[model samples]
Target: MNAVDSALCEAFAPSGVLRVSINFGNPVLATRGTNGEPQGISVDLATELARRMDLPLRFVTFDAAGKSVAAVAAGDADFGFFAFDPVRGKEIAFTRPYLLIEGSYLVRSESHIQTNDDVDRSGVRLAVGTGSAYDLFLTRELKHAEIVRGSTSPEVVNTFLRDGLDVAAGVTQQLLADAKRLGGLRLLRGNFMVIRQAMGVAKSRGDEVATWLDCFVSEMVRTGVLRRAVARHQIGAMSAPEVKP
Candidate 1:
């Protein structure tokens, strides 16, 4: 790898290890390995980022994107992988997305909700992860349905099951995993939103490293490293985003 700017290095991995907050809830992005190691597309990319920087790697795991974003905002981690959201823009700066995932709704198999459009109806109760991109989106868009909050993204499916929710809104991959693991759960045919998965740092870090991360992600995608990681993770029905201009 080419030498990196020393100042950027100090700013990004001050503790020697490139500390990256990773959300394990999004199955498309990350999951546990056979030996209980962190494993997935994001983990592979984070490892690659550290390797390129010649920094040791440390992953600070979280069950939710909100917690991962909070770690970035609080400067507890050098950076984190999360869905890009305007609400998070207040405290953190995110690079252009390296991946795109779909947001969809899950419902009981017996329900009449065959499409994404069928979910937003009166008396419908939707379970969503608190402070998540899906929650943020549904809060603003679902006029008739009541939004029920789960502590984390992975918990949304549980909440939906326990509460007999009319719909469960979250990452499509997450919904798919739940649908497969649990009986009588199915996803709406189409996605309700396209989630931009990006890396983030505290807003105070300024544009220099953010710009570098943006470029780093693009290079990873262009070089096929990211796409390969996605394939290894078995992330179905998704694609690495086009490099941001």
Candidate 2:
């Protein structure tokens, strides 16, 4: 049983404050608010979690989920939102995923690639965010297409367009936005993958936070809290699976 009290403060609320990693590049889950503060579904959830724990909330911003993962793993941030990937699993412990986002490819409108099946060819070049979940997945799955890693997620689309790459792979929402903004680009008919969004604490941070966060996330999904945040942030109807019993 988890205690509502700060009996486990050291694990989650170190320094009498809970520092939440805000991955602002993940447009589906986070973005900058009107006031230039971190504002999005993840921010709301993190804030509520801190409130419930009776701790002051502190925001630690990261431009990429990989950076946030590294920060949390290095014990620089208390916890962060991340996609559940085996590669990252080695370094951090993940809670059950509460949200899922589509991962797909975008290509030049005049390109021969019309579907997801066309993306794996020998000459295809895909641009991906270095250390992103899609990059890790494609690095393992893409046998022929070459992957070029940009410095971060938000830069991937520009890197793809600038380099004349065959495809840009990342969160589908980001791809859609790029297609709308950059023009001359379109998303493949189907998704290449589904990114499972979850929270993680560093393995070095101990098992207590992991256990507590797992329960907290499941509750957040089961109740309407997670849904409300999604609606409030206008994050779109990506996908929210019921928490496993």
Candidate 3:
């Protein structure tokens, strides 16, 4: 093992605390609270992992999921929790999924756009975070809807909030949370795509950690810890766990 891995092993050998990195952009995953401390589903899950492992926890935040995954690959973080994708799989090892989520279009409640069908019409523009999975998904699925890409979710949301686009397509979890807070935005009842969320570790790190994480995630799902966390956070877009094959 390398120095970082050796150090991590030594660190965990005594206390079992693992240093994990997660994206703060997705409120359902990790985000700063009013007190400026980290909070959210991934944060809770990380804490739970630490508890189950009889270890303390360390957290590192990134602006996006891609960044978080990159951190894992660079050994800057031990692991990451984010949506799993085939493209990302080539770069990192991923645990079996703990949760499923879908993407949806968010629109102002007063806007006439009410469905995916509505978004297919010409002249309708959908805002998305540039270079994000949502952007790629929207590009593939919505041939007729013009895409307006922003660098961040807040930028995309703000553009849509200001009427710059007819809709904003994002993860349903975030859309629902934004709807609750902003009042004017609403998540359409239907989904555009389904995504599985998993923990990612560096590809170079061998499968030991990934195997452990996968087993832990399976137990969390079976014991209702995953469900409780989602419900407690009111993450409306998350789907119930699927039985592992």
Candidate 4:
């Protein structure tokens, strides 16, 4: 077995507790329900990781992606389950990507903006959650679009739904799930760019932990567990990295 597998054997050895941090913003990661309990792909993955490690799982919620990164940096969380960005990487160490993702534009189904060219028009405003990876990507890539930044994804979505903006940019998975609920919004045909999703651990923690997480992630992908989990959550339709090539 690999070092990560060995670490798992030790970490879960009937007496360890692995505290992982998760964000509720990303459905593929963690999110809270109306009842205020944790739910979503991140929760599922954390639970599974705990099961494999035979350890207990604890969750802490944050309102922003930056705060989630802070939690890991402050040692309040052993690791974080969220999109890993290079900017945030400076604050914390990241595991090898366990999954891949693509950014997308979300707009009302009835909206006239249907293609990439449409989004570039002067009047088309793009809403995004402040400090989100999507916001970062949009600021960097969609230079021509006016950005209407919100503090949360729901706020951003609601603003767009109310016609406060012409379009909103977000993770393709979130847009897809929300589209089912709103019934009037649609994800654009293509993605802005692809990103890798990995776990973030405190930099103070030795690289051993990050190395183990990377191995665990690699194992999950190789064994098809990661793909299975994505399908189980009905998020398989979202774009993921082309298998290591």
Q: State each model's CA lDDT, in order.
A: 0.82, 0.85, 0.73, 0.72
TM-score of each: 0.93, 0.95, 0.81, 0.81
Q: Least lDDT summed over 10 consecutive residues: which range in candidate 4?
A: 6-15
lDDT by residue for model 4 over 1-245, one digit each (tens)?
24236554443222356776777666666667789988766776677777766677788788777678888887777778667777787878877677777778888878898786689767778888888888777677765779887557656677777766888787787787778877877888998777678777776676666666666667677777777778877765442443442
lDDT of 3 by residue, 62-94 (tens): 777667777777878777787877667887787
Sort by lDDT, best first: what order? 2, 1, 3, 4
Off by over 4 Å in 1: none
Sort the candidates on TM-score, descending order: 2, 1, 4, 3
The C-alpha RMSD in Å for every predicted model, in order, reads 1.7, 1.5, 4.4, 3.7
Error of 2 at 208 (Å): 2.2
Candidate 4 TM-score to native = 0.81
Best candidate according to TM-score: 2
Measured by TM-score, how close is model 2 to the native structure? Answer: 0.95
TM-score of model 1 (CA atoms): 0.93
Off by over 4 Å in 2: none
Candidate 2 C-alpha lDDT tens digits along 1-245: 36675567876767788898889777887888789898888888898888778888999998988898888888788899999999999989999988888898988889999889888889899999988999999999989899998658888889987888888888888888889997988888888998889988888777877888898898888887887877777766454677563
